[model samples]
Structures are given as structure tokens and as C-alpha cells.
Target chain A: MLPVFDVVLAAAILVSAALALWVRDRIAAVSGFLVTGLLVSLSWLRLGAPDVALAEAAIGAGLTGALLLRSAHRIPCAPSKALPPSLWCAAGALAIAISGAIVWTVTSFGAAPVYPSLVADNLPESGAQNPVTAVLLNFRAWDTLLEIAVLFVALTVVIMVAPARPRTAPLGPLVQPFARVLLPLTVLIGGHLLWQGGHAPGGAFQAGAVLAGGAIALGLSGVIGSKLTRQNGLALLAIAGLAIFALAALAAEVLTGALLGYPAGEAKTWIIAIESALTLSIAATLFLLFFGPAERH
Target chain B: MSELSLLVLLPFLAATLTVAVPGRAASLGLVATAANALLVVSLCREIIARGAVEQVIGGWAAPLGITFVGDGLAAVMLAMTAIVSLAITAQAMSTPGRAGFWPLWMATLGALNGLFLSGDLFNLYVAFEILGLAAVGLTALAGTPMALRAAFDYLTAGLAGSLLILLGIALSYSVTGRVDLETVVVLTESSNGRIALALIAAGLAVKAALFPLHFWMPAAHSSAVPVASALLSALVVKGALYLALRLSIEGGAGAEFLRSALAVLGTGGMLWGAWNALRAERLKLLVAHSTVAQIGLIALAIGVAGDPLQNGLWTAAALLMLSHALAKAAMFLAVGRIAEALGHDRISGLNREELRPGAAEFAFAIAAISLVGLPPTAGFIGKWILIEGLVDEGAVHWIALLLLGTALSAAYLSRVVSRCLRGGPHVSATAQRLPWRSGDVAALGLATGALLLGLAAALPLTLLEVPFA
Candidate 1:
């Protein structure tokens, strides 16, 4: 019964992915993409990777879908031109070939499955009970450090481009009450996720996405985006995560002789400190990216 | 503090500070570049003294944790990056660019350091992500419709290349249950491993702008500000080429198929880029195309150098990269100065009777000489090593290809050098000397460095002897 449900879900994913490519309307294509992300996250859950699933749903689907929806509104709502039949055929062929190659390769992999057992054995000293958290915050903190830099670079690029101020309409009367509820709910969820990261499937990214969703909604409602321009402290908040993370990593090395090496019993403290800063930074960055950095001065 | 980690992370911290305090950006950028140069020099010394230095991040052992390795190749690249970055920073200081340039440049520097030092494939991918985005921002800093279009195309191409790299890493991880560079040998044991490498090579080829996939590079390079162009053409693309080199060295005999294919593509890019460069109307465009050809030459060297562990001939590729970065950066900076003085960049407009060729033009000629493999320049020495190696291996056809590439380079570069040499008939009696600027000094210094590196080639050669950690 579960296998049948998985197959159906996979088929649904393929259908929605194809729809995203073929849809004529910008909103429709984005909606299709969002559906695909959602279904893929569900597949991850079935595979027992709730951490990946949470990230895929929140950041990959939720935040990205919001960003795309904003872009769709700004862009002219026109039907996309159809590609030539030959071009379509060529694309289909290439896609099929790539999928076939991936399938063939995955089936033949003689994977030694090294990391899971290794993470398990070392989880005690890592200061995080969750193996995923242990790996992300302690075992391989360097990659996470670089990953934050990647996010920061993306934010920098978006700020560098200095997009034209987005024109937003006034919100309806119902939005105030809606936002009042959403604002608190988002804060609650974000705090819960940040606190739960060390022991559960929630983390900085998912929490940030939830917070950004609220921020973006507020932005679209003409409530506060105007005041939070690039000149505001939002930029400082955005830089805080990377700045703190890099300093901590360097300080760890100075204190312990190993890059990103935490204190013997204080790894959880370090990880939580980093993630709390990251949650705020990521939220500010995503909010800034979705809304314009400046809104007509 | 470990210099290797500092070299990568300090730039990032500086970039953040620059963003936070925009008024102090220039000071922050200068300090960061100085610190970066010092770290690179110190790291090179450490690598020489210790035979290679490795730092285990988070104190987690390999196959679980990432490591930063300062090997012979990494040390030289870092040194080369330091040299170019300092010069570019000098130019940037002299010419105040858009508000965003400093932060973007600092981020790019950090990304390049991370790239060269990273030993984990996944970690390398993350570095590429930052590098690619920062470079795209640098390109878009020109704030023109053309620059924006070029930046978008560059971003698309970079993302496509990155996708291929990530896919290859994923497959390799599945094959070996590890993402460390050493697991490459295990991945190559099966057809799946070979395919993964092929995918990675293909992706890196795009990033390196290796032939057939190099279409997005020239426009992107030519459309940016001068320092940005120099950064993109001379340094940014080298990240991909560096990874390709690492893979070839690690893969060894197993990478033969990919190497041969790279050689064939490099041969094509050699002719193709030269052909396009000869017909280029603008000076910057010509230099950009020449980069494509020069990358082909370096790729050819990597292709022909069979086992670096045995023969160490791949050092020729490193030398070529070193020379090209210096020569190409010098050419771009010099072109920027010439364009500034003349008010235009058209090759036909180079012989302005009112203003005789000055330091900038002279710098361009010397850079072209190095690029054309003339004696007493690093380019010539690099080619000499590559040619002598081929001869030792009895690979005469490879020798023929190098000579052909050499002649083509001289032909296209002479198009500008000959124009710059116009003096007796073309110059007016009242021709004025160009005013001194920091750009001229930077260009001349880098050009002279390329020229003298021929005599000093042994310095880098000695550095390149340090083994991988």
C-alpha cells in the first residue's frame, strides 16, 4: 500500500514538473514548481529524512515560491511563446538521456555507506543528539560556514543590483487582523524551530523561511517595507550571521588549534549561538530579496 | 592562527564589514588585501617548509569532516591570486567604482581562497557557488543594459555548470560513500565513477570557458569594468581550471579518456579563440578572446602531462596559468588605461595623432610580447617547459599544435602591438604624454612581473615541488 502511494506521488511530481516547464502563464508555472517542491519534500519524508524534507518544504518550496510569486507580479503577465516542435523534441530527448544515465549510475553504485555509522559513533562528543545537527553544526561545520557565505553572497548580489522600488498597493481591511495572527504565529514557529534544531528536524533555514514569509506578507501589504531600506539596520542584521560565524570559526582555531573545532563540552552552545544569529540574518536577507532593497527612496 | 583558514575566512569578514560600513570600504578592502597577501606568502613558506599543510575543520576526521590542504599547486595559485588581487586592488583604489564593487570583490577573493584550499568536493561546490554569484555581481556593477544582459547570461551559464558539478558530486558520493577528493580513485574503478568524472569535467569546462562552451565568456568579460574584467578573465575562471587540474592529477591514468578529450577541445579553442581575437574590433574584446586561447593552452598542458606524481610535467600547466593570469590581467588593465586616455577602445582609433603612445600603450606591448611567448617572459618559459616535455615523450604532434598555437597568438596580438608602435608617420609634433595614474603603474608592474617571471620561473617551480597533504 505504501509502495503504491509512493509511485503515485512520484508520478504526480513528474506531472507537476512538466507543467512547470510547459505552463504559459508565469503564475501557473510558479505554482506548478511549488507543487513539485512540495511533493519532492513528501518523498524525502517517506525516505526517513525529515530534516531534508523540512528544508525542502520551507526554504525550497515555501520561500522560493513566495519569491517567484513576487517576481511574477512584477513581470508582465503574458502568455509565454511556444517553442518549436524540434526544440521541444530535443529538450525531451536530452532530459530522457540524463534521467536514464542517473538511473543507471545509481543502481550500480557499490556505496560503502560510511558516514552514518561514523556520525553515530562520534555523536556523543558532538554535543548534539540529532545526528543531522551533529554533522551540520559540529562534524562538518566548515561546509556550513561556506554555505552561509554562499547565502550571504546571494544577498549581496541582490543588494548590488539595487532593483527598482516595487510599487505595492494598500492592504485590504481584513489584512490587519490576518497579519496580526500570522505575525505572532510566524514568530512562535520560528522560535520553536531555532530552539528545536539541536534535537529535531527544524533549524535556522526553515525558521528563517517562516519568518520571511511573514515579513514578505507585511511588505506586500504596504505596512513596513518602505522604512526598512538598504540603509536601515536590516543590512547589518543580514551581515551579522556571516560575520559572527567566521569570527567564531577563527576564534575556535585560535583557542583549540583546529579550524571550526568547538570546546570539548560546549559544541551545542556554539551551534545554537551560530544558528540563532543565522535565523535572523536569513530572514532579513530573504525579506530584502523578495521585496526591493529600496522603495522609492 | 592557521593561515590557510584565515586566507579564506578573513576576506569574508572584511566583505561583511565593508557592507556594514560603506564609508570605510576602501580602507577595509586595502587592509584585507594586505592581510590576504601576507597570509598567502606565509602559507607558501609553510608549505615549502612542511611539504604540505592540512587542517582538519571541526577536528572531525576525513570522510566526515572537510579539510583544507595547502599543497604545491594550491600554494602557487594562492600566490598568483595574491599578486593579481593586490594589483587589482591598487587599480580599484585609484579609480573609485560603484558603491558595491568593494564588497563584491572581497567576497570573490574569499571564494577563490576557499576554492583552492578545499579538499572536499561538496565544500568545493559551495565555494563555487559564492564565487559564481560574486562574479556575476561584479559583472553587473557596470550598470548598463549590455552589462546586465551579459551578467544574466554569465549567471545562467555559471548555474548550469554548477548543477553539473553538484550532480557529479552526488553521484560520486553515492559511489564511494565519501565526498573527499581522495575518494576519486575509488570512484574511477567503475564506469559510474568515470561518468561522474566526465560530468564534472564537462561542468568545469563550462566554468573554465573551455572551447565550445566558452560562448558566454567574452561578452561577460568585455562588458565589465576594467578591474572586474581583469578579475574575471585572469583570476575567476582559473578556479574551475584549478579543480580540473586537481581531478586529473588525482584520477591519473584513469582520466586518460577525459584528458585526451580535453586536449582535442583545447586544440579547437586555440584556433577558434585566435580566429575570433584576430577579427575583434575592440581592445578589451581581443584580450578576452586571447584568454580563451590561453586557457586552451593551459588545458593542453594538463592533458599532455600524464602523471604529475611521476614526471611533474603538469607543473608546466601551473606555469602557463601563472603566466597567463599575469599577462592577461596586465593586458586588461593596460587596455583600461588606453581606453581612458583615448576616450574609446576601437583598435582603428589607437593611433590618435594628438596623443602619442605612452606608458599604458607600452605596457600593452610588453604584455602582448609575454602572451606571444617571446623570450625572457613567463609565457615563453612556460611554453618551453611544455614543448620540452612533449619532446621527451616523443609527442611531436603535440609539439606541432603548440607551435601553431604560438604562431597564431603572435599573429593576433601583433594586431594591437603593431598599432601601438605607430610613431614616426602617425604621431603629430604636438603629441602629448599621457598623465600618470595608478592604473598605469599597476599595469606596468604586472606586465614587468610576467616578463621577469621567466628569469624567476625557478621560484614557482621550487614552490610547486611540495606534495599534497
Candidate 2:
């Protein structure tokens, strides 16, 4: 039964992904992608990676879908002109060859779990029961910090390059009521996810993305209109995470005698504190990425 | 303090500050870049003062946790990135239509810093995405039809490259069960895992604009605004090349085959790029194509791994990258000024009849000399080390190719230099006053640094003796 479920989910994922790529209509393709993300999340759950499944659901299905939908609405959904027969044939052949190569390569990969013993040995010292969190927060904290930076940078680029222009029309009626109901619940859920990251299947990134989703919902609903002017306070709020993290690391050097080295026994507390700060920052950064630069009223 | 964490965080803090300080965009941007530069300099000093700085993020040690390791290689790259970024920021501030350039530029700076410092596979992917998006935005900031078209093509290419990289990362993670660089390095001892590493390298090479994968580069770089072109050509592409180098160093014997493949591609790129650059009709396009050739040279140097004689080759590549960054940025800025004065950038159609010998023209000559690997310049030093290494390795073919590439570069660059030098009786009367002394000084300073860096190579080379050595 388990094997059957895996097969079914895998099949669904493949079909949806293919449709997402092949569909001509931008909106339809985006919906196909959303479905594909859902299937991928399901597959992650079936594989016993609930944390990854959570991330897939929030980031893959939720945030990415929203982004695609917004972009699709912003840009006209024009289809490309048909390619000549020879070019079409060549493209098809190339696609088939690539698919074949990918399949062959994936099937040929030998099973190897070299890091299991290492992860198990270090799991205790990592101050987290969940290996994923241990890996994400402790073992690979540099990556996470930089990933936060990536989000921050992306937001900055979006704001700087695509400055918020004045919108002619206000939000439709449906969006305001929807946002009013959804925003608080989203904030609550996001807080829970962030707080639960150490022991369970939620973390700063997933939580932050969720928080951004709520903020975006509010912004789109005209509760927060696109103002043409920049907000200094919001800008400062956006960078709070990075500044806090760097300061914490600097403090760590003074307290623990190494950069980013937490106090030995109080590792969990420090990790949580850092994670909490990161969560707020991540949320703000993601919100900025979505809303762009806040325009003046 | 771990050199790695500092390397990543410094630019990030700057990026955040740049966006946060809303009213004074230019000053905020400058402060961010300047702060990052100071951090990079300090990091370099630390590496030189100590050995390589290694930190497992969150106090988690390697193989189980993510690690940030900074060696001589990373330090040099970071320093170079800081320098180029500072110069570009200075230039961008004075350029027209620079209202939105600072924030995106800062973001790009942060992403580049992250790319250089990251020691995990997934983290590297995230950085690549950030860099790719920022670069695309920067490309589009020129706000011309040509710039938009070029940016769109660049965006598509960048996305495709990123997807390939993502696929490679997923495959590697599946095989190794960990995303940490050290863990993957340990796992690559087997032949079965080697293939996954190769896929990752190929994806990286595509983004690095090596040879056949560089189809989107010249158009994207040449068509954008001058500062944008400089950043894209000199620094943005180097992020991927730096990754390729890091992977080759960490992957051990599993990467040998991949390195050979890179050598082939690099040679192809060098020859092809040089040939195209020579035949190119536009001055900016010529410089852009020359960048392809220069990047190819660096890749080739990196690919000639595992030989005892070439143990110091990475330093040579680093120096080459630095020289290229400075010279290229200066060239682009000079071209911007020249184009502004002459009202066009077409090579053959440059109004030599009306041209005057000024700061822009002088800066162009200096940049051209450095670019063509002339004496006393950093470019010459880089070429010298490469040629010396090639001779020691008995790689006559590579040496010949290098010499040929250098000659072609000189020929193409000299065309612009000579054109600017043509101050005959019929000089143009409509030349506008060059608006920003700071811009010219920045270009001149960088061009001078390119030359001065060669004489002071010992300082940076001393820092290269980290884990790799």
C-alpha cells in the first residue's frame, strides 16, 4: 500500500510538472505548477520528511504560487509564435534526449548514506532532536544566514529595480474582507511555526514566508495601498534581522571565544533566540520582496 | 571568529542598511559598500595573520552542520569583489538614471559575497538565485529597448542555468544525504557519486560563461549601462567560476575528470571569444567579448589542477580576476564617457575627427594597456604566472593558446586606444564637459591599482596558503 501510494504521488507530480511546462497559457501553467508543488509536498510526507513537506507546502505551493499568479496578472499572457518545422523537431529531439539522460542518471545513482553516522553522533551535541533543524540551524547555520541575506537582497533588488508605481484602481471588495479574516490567523500560525522549529517541523524560513503571505494579502487588499513614496521606518524594519544576527555573532566572539560559537551548555537557548530574531527579519524581508518599496500616500 | 560567517554577513548587513536608509540613497549605498570593503580587508588581514578561518554555523561542526570556511582563495576573491564593487558604486552614483541602481547594486554585492563565502550546496543555490535575479534587474535598469531585450534573454539563460544547478543539487543531496560541502567532499571518493559532481560542475560552468555556454553574455553585458556592464562582465560571472574552483578543490579525485572537461571548454572559450572580439564592430562589444576570453583563461587555469607546479595557479587566477575586474570596469566607465561625448559607441564610426585628448581618453588608454597584458600591469603578472606554470607543466599547446589570445586581445583593444588617440586637425567642437571628477578618478584609481597589484602580488599570494596548500 505504501509503495502504491508513492507511485501514485510520483505519477501525479510528473504529470503536473509536465503540464506546467507544456501549457501555453501563463495562468494555467502557474496552476499546474501549484499542483505539482502540492504533489511534491505529499511525496515528501510519504518519504517521512515532514519538515521538508512543510517547507514544500509553504514555500513551494503557497508563496511560489502566489508570486507566479501575481506576475501572470501583471504581464500580458501572450503565446509565442510557432517555430518553424525544423526548429520544432530539433527542440523536441533535444527535450527527449535530455529527459532520457536524466532518467538514466537518476536510476543509476547508487544508494549511499555516508553522513548518517556523523549526523547521529553530532545530533546530541547539536542541541536539537530534529536532524533537519540541527542541520539547518546548527550544522548549516551559515547557509541559513546567507539564505536570509538572499531574501533580503532579492527584496532590495525588487524594490530598487521595480519601484512601486501608483495604481489607478483600489482593491476589489472580495480581497479586503478576505484579508481582514486571514491576516491575524496567518500571523498566529506563523508565530507557532517559528516557535516550534527546534523540536518539530517548522522553522524561521517557513514561518517568515507565511508571515509575508499575510502581509502581501493585506497589501493586495488595499488595506495597505501601494504608495508612491518610500518609508524610512519600513526600510529599517526590513534590515533588522541581518543587523541583529551580525551583532549576535559579534557578541558570541566575546562570550564564547569564537565567532558564531554559542555558549556550550546554553546552545538551545541561543539558537532559539537567533532563530526568533531571524524569523522576524525573514518575515519582514519576504514582505518587502512581495510588496516592493512602500509608496508614499 | 570564523572568516566565513563574517564574509557572508558583512555584505548582508550593508545590503540591509542600503535599503533601510531611504532618504539618502547614494550615501547609504556608498556606506554599505565601504563597510563591506573594510570587512573584506579585515578578513584578508585575519587570514593572513592566522591561517584559514573555518566556522561551522551555529557551532555545529562540519559534515553534520553547514560550515563557512575561508581560505586564501576566498579571501582574495572577496577582496577583489569589494574593490570592484566600490569602484562601480562610485561610477553608478554619478551616472544619469541612477536613482534605482544603488539598492539592486547592493543586493548584488550581498549575493556575490554570499556566493564566495558559502560552504554548502543548497546555500550556494540560494546565492545563485539571488545573484541571477539581481543581475537581471541591473541589466534592465538601463531602461532602453535594447537593454530590455538583452535583459530578457539574460533572464531566460540565467533561469535555465539556475534550474540545472538546482537539479544537480537535488541529485547530489539524494546520493550523499547531506548538503554540506565537506560532507559531499567526503562522499565523492566513490565513482558512483562522481557523476553527480560532474553535473553540478557543468551547471556551474554554464553560469560562469565558459565557452559554448556563454551565448547570452556579450549581448547582455555590452547592451547594458556602463556600470552595469562592468559589474556583470567582471564580477557577476566570477561568482560561478569561484564556485567551480571551490568544488574542484573540495571534490578531490572525483573532480579530476570534470577539471579536464573544464580545460577543454575553457580553451574553446578563450579561442572563440578572442576571435569574436577581434571581429566585433562595437567598442563595448569588443570589451565584452574580451571579458569572455579573459574569464575563459581563468577557467583554464583553474582546470589545470592537481599538478604540483600549478599548485599556485589559483592565485594567478585570482590576480587575473582582480586585474580584469579593475581594467574592465575602468574600460566600461571610459566607454560610457566616450559614448556620452561622441553620442555613439560604434567602433568604426567614432568621431576621431572631433575627438579631444582628455581624462576619459587617457583613462581608456591606461585601461587598454592593462587589459592587453602590457608591462607593469596586473594583467601582465597574471599572464606571466600562467605562462610560467604552463611551461613547467609542459603544456605547450596551452601556452600557445594563451599567447594567441593575448595577441588577439591587444589587437582588438588597440583599435579603441588608437581611435581615442586620433586628435588630428579636425577635432569635434561639441564635446560636453565630463560631469563627475569622482568617476574619472575612480576609473583612474582602479586602473592604477591594476598595475600596482602586480608589483605587490606577494602580499595576496602569501594569503593563498590555506587548507589547499
Candidate 3:
């Protein structure tokens, strides 16, 4: 019965993904993508990775969908051109064959994972209750640092290339009032999610995405202007995480006699400090990506 | 602190300051690049004295995480990057028409640094993305219709390359269950894991503009401003090639098939690029096409298997890259001055009566000599080592092809050089005397560096043999 439920959710996700690709209307396609993300998140839940499920819901469904929708509104729709039946059939056949091969391979060769016990053994020293967060923030912090740099670079490129300001009208009156009421509540919830991430299925990324959502809503409501301008304050805010994380690691070498080794018994505090900085930076970065460069004073 | 971390951070810090400084763009650019060059010099000193520096960034342990291991190859490349960037910055400062050149250039510098020092596969991807975007931004900075079109084409190609690389990363991660370089090395020893490695190497080769994958490069590099062109041709393409070399060395047998494929494509690129360069009408276009040939030669050197004799080839390839960086930047700068004086860069139009021989023409001659692989020049030293290495390997066919490519290079470069030398028909004319002195000095300095560097090979080679890896 449980397997059937998992299959149903996976089927729904596949169907939604197909619809997202097949739809002619850009707005509808974005919505379809959102549905696909949600279904995928549910599938992750079924697989017993609730932490990933939360990340998928927040990042995949919520933030990515929002970005797609915002960008879609800016893009002029192309005239719909139907693909030839032959091409469509060929694509469908290819997809089916590939997926079938993958399924066959996985089912036949699947073995019990070897690293779970290793992760479990080292989990306590990582200063995080959640194994995935421990892996991401402690054991593999270098990847996360570089990932943050990637986001920063992407933001820079978008600012350099994209038009500074949209020519469209500001958010309508109806959306403005609602945004004001919801912004604080959203921030509160985002903070909770971030706070709970060490022990639960929420982390800095999910919290940051939620926070970016609030900021984007504010921008859309015209509370924040759409002018592509450089805000030095915001840029500094965005860089704080990287600076703090890098410095902390460097400082550890002097204090602890090993690089990236936290001072004895202070691991939790260091992790919290890094996560807090990252949360703000990640939120600011996502907001900048959506808003483009803020108008320079 | 390891030299690798400093090498990566210096440009990044410079970029941040460049953006933070509130001033005329040229002044900011000058300060940032000068500071960056100074940092590079200091790093070179460290590398020469102590060897290559390795650091696990954020103090993460390898296999489970990321690390940065700099060896002799990385130090030499970093120094080359610094020299080219400094020369290009001087050229940009002299030419004041560009508005947003400095920021984009700084970003490019930062991206190059990131690419050079990164030891992890995923970090390299991030570096690629950063470099790709910055290069595209620089391409579009010219703001001409042709430049915009070229930039868009470049952007399309770059995005496709990046997507393929990302997909490769994802697949590799799924297979190995880790994204770090050391962990991937362990996992890739198995035959089944070779497929993922091949995919990644293929993706990187496309980004590096290997032969058939180089269609977008010439157009993008040729259409940009001279300073921009110098940077793009001399530095940007090298970033991806550097990453490919790093992976090949680290990946061992898993990458053998991919490396051989690169060698074949590189050989084809060398032949095709030289053929086109020999016939190119525009001087800048000729230089741009020549970059394809040069990069191909470097890739070929890297593709050769590691052996006692082959190690010299690696050093020779490094020297080749350094020489090309200096010679190419000089060529571009000299041509920019020529175009300014003559009002156009059409190679056939140099016979007009009003054109007078000046410092620019002299600079062009010196740069051309280096490009043609003349004696005592850096290009000659590089080619000589390569030829000797090939002879040791009994690769007579490749040696023949290399000589042929050199002859073709000489043929094209001499065409431009001779035209600049010839006295055109005299006319009663008052064309403004070319502001050739400063630009000429910059070009001369670089060309001199190219020549002198060959004689001082021990310095860079010592830097390249750093024990960080």
C-alpha cells in the first residue's frame, strides 16, 4: 500500500513535469513547474528524507517557481509552434527508454548504503542534530562556501547583463496592503525555520528562500522600487557571510592548531554564527537576483 | 598561509575594492590592477622560494570535502595571468572611452584566480560559470551591433557549455556520492566510473574551446575592444584548459580516453586555426584565430602521457602559454594604436599615403616576431622544447605538423608586419600624429618580457615545480 502511494506521487510529478514542458502559455508552464516541484517534494517525503522534502518545498517549489514567474512576466511570449508528430513520438520514446534503463539498473544493482554508519558516528562532533545539515555545514563547508560564491557571481552577472529597471507599473493597490501585513509574519516564520534547522527539516536555505519571498513581495508591492541600482549597504550585507565564514576558519588555525577545527567545546556557537551570517547573505543574494541591482543613490 | 589561498583571494579582494571605490573608472582600474600585480609578484616570490602551496579551504578534510592544492603549474599560470592583466589594464587606462570596462575586468581577474586555485570539481564549475559570465559581459561592453551579436552568440554557447558541465557534475555526484576531487579520484578507479569522468572531461573540453567546440570563440574575441580582446584571447580561454589539465592529472586512467580525444581535437584545431589565420583579412581576426592554434598546442602537450621526457613538454607548454599571453597582449595593444592612427584595421588598407611609420609599427614588428617564433623570443623557446619532447616520443608526424603551423603563423604575421613597414604613397596630409608612445611602451614592455622570459626559464619552471600538490 505504501509503495502504491509512492508510485502515485511519482507519477503525478512526471505528469506535471510533462505538462510544464508541453504547455504553450508561459504562465501556465511556470505553474506546472511549481506543481511538479511540490509533487517531487512529496516524493522525497515518501522516501523518508523529510529534510530534503522541506528543502525541495521551499527552494524548488517556492523560490524557483517565484523566480521563473517573475522572469516569465518580463519575457514576451513567442508564437506557439507545434512540434511534428514524428519528433514528439521520438522524444517520448527516448525518454521512456532512458527511464526504463535507469530503473532496471537501480533495481538490479541497488545495495545497502555504506556511509550511513560513518555519518552516524561523526554526527555528534558535527555540532548539528541533522545529518544532512552536518554534512553540508561542517564536514563539507567548503562546498557551501563556494556555492555561496557561485550565487554571488550569478547575481553580479545578472546585474551586469539584465536591464536595471522594469518598465512595468508598480504593484497594484490590492497587493500592497496584503504584502505589508504578511511581511513580518513571513520573517518570523523564516526565523523559526532557521532556528529549528539544526534538529529539524528546515535550514538556512529554506529560511533564506522564505525571507527572499517576503522581500520580493515587498518589491512587487512597490514598497521597494524596481530601479536596478547598486546598494552598497546591501552588497556588504550580502558579503558578510563569506567574510565571517572564511575568517572564522582562519582564526581556528591559530586557536585550535588546526584549520577549520572549532575551538574545543565551542562548536555549536561557531556553527550558529556561520549559519546566521549565511542566512542573511543568502536572502540578500536571492532578493538581488530577483530585483536586479538596486538603484544607486 | 598557503600561496594558493593568497593567489585566489588577492584578485577577489581587488575586485571587491574595485567595486567599492567611488572614483573615475580608469583610476579605480589602475589601482586595483596595480595592487593585484603586486600581490601576484609576492605570490611568485613565495612559489619560487617555498614551492606550490596547498590549503584545504575552510579547513575541511579532503575526500569528504573540498581542498585547494596549488602546484608548480598553478603558480606559473597565476603569474602569467597577473602579467597579462596588468598590461591590459594599462591599455584600458590609456583608452578612456569605455565606461564599465574596469568592473568587468576585475570580475574577470577574480574568476581567473578562482579557476586557477580551485582543487575541487564543483568549485571549478563555479569558477567556469563566473569566468563565462564575466567574459560575456566584457564582450558586450563594446556596445556595437556586431559586438552585441557576437556576445549573444558567445553567451548562448557558454550557457550550453555550463549546463552540460552542471549535468556532468550531477551525474558524477550521483555515481560517486561525493563532489570533491579527492573523493571522485577514489571512486573513478573502477571501470564503470570512467563514463562519468568522460562526460565531465567532454563538457570541460567544450568550455575550453577545443577544435570543433571553438566556433564561438573567434567571433567573440575578435569583435571586442582591443584591451578586451587581449584579455579574452590571452586569459579567459586558458582558464578552462587549465582546469582540464588539472583533472587529467588528478583523474589518472579514468581520464586517459578523454585526454586522447582532446589531443586529436587539439591537433585538428591547430591545423584549422593556422589555415584560417594565414588567410585572414583583418589583423585582429588573425590574432584571434592564432589563439585557437596556440591553445590547441598547449592541449596537445598536456595530452601526452607522463614520462621523464614528457615532463619537459609540460614545462614547455607552460612556457608557451606564458609567451602567448605576453605576445598576444602586445600584438592587440599595438594593433589598437595602429587602428587609432589609420582609422581602421583592414589589413589591405595599410598602403594609404597619409599613414606614417611610428612607434606603433615598431611595437607591432617586435610582437609579430614573437608570434612567428623567431629566435630568442619566448615563442621559440616554447616550440623548441615541444619539438625536442616530440622527437623523444618519436612523434615525427606531430612535429611536422607543428613546423607547418609555425610556417603558417609566420606567413600571416609577416603580412601585417611588412605592410606596416612599407612606405605608402606620399600625399600633402595633416593627419593627427598617433598617440603612440604610451601604448608602444606597454607593447614593447610585454614583448620584451616574452623575449627575456625564455632566457629566464628557470625562474618560472622552479615556480611550476612547487610541491603543494
Best by DockQ: 1
* N/CA/C clash count, model 1: 0
Give a tens-digit lDDT track for model 1, residues A180-288: 8889899999999888888889888889988988888877776664767546688789889899999999889888999889988988888898889989998988887
Using lDDT, rank the candidates from best to worst.
Answer: 1, 2, 3
Worst 10 residues of 1 chain B by lDDT: B423-432
> Best by lDDT, which number?
1
Q: What's candidate 3's DockQ score?
A: 0.31
The local lDDT score (0 to 100) that residue B432 gets in candidate 1 is 47
Error of 2 at B249 (Å): 3.2
lDDT of 3 by residue, A173-236 (tens): 8988899888998799889988998988788888888888888788787777654225567766
Q: All candidates: CA RMSD in angstroms?
A: 2.0, 3.4, 3.9
Q: Which stretches of candidate 2 lie over 4 Å from their true place?
A: A77-79, A84-111, A114-128, A163-180, A219-235, A293-297, B1-4, B28-50, B93-97, B182-191, B251-254, B304-315, B353-355, B424-430, B465-469
Q: lDDT of each prediction vs. the true structure?
A: 0.88, 0.76, 0.73
The per-residue C-alpha lDDT of model 3 at residue B46 equals 69
Model 2 chain A lDDT-worst window of ten: A226-235
From the highest TM-score down, the ranking of the candidates is: 1, 2, 3
Q: Tell me how much of the true interface, by contacts, candidate 2 captures.
A: 0.55
For model 1, the superposed segments whose C-alpha errors exceed 4 Å read: A76-90, A295-297, B423-434
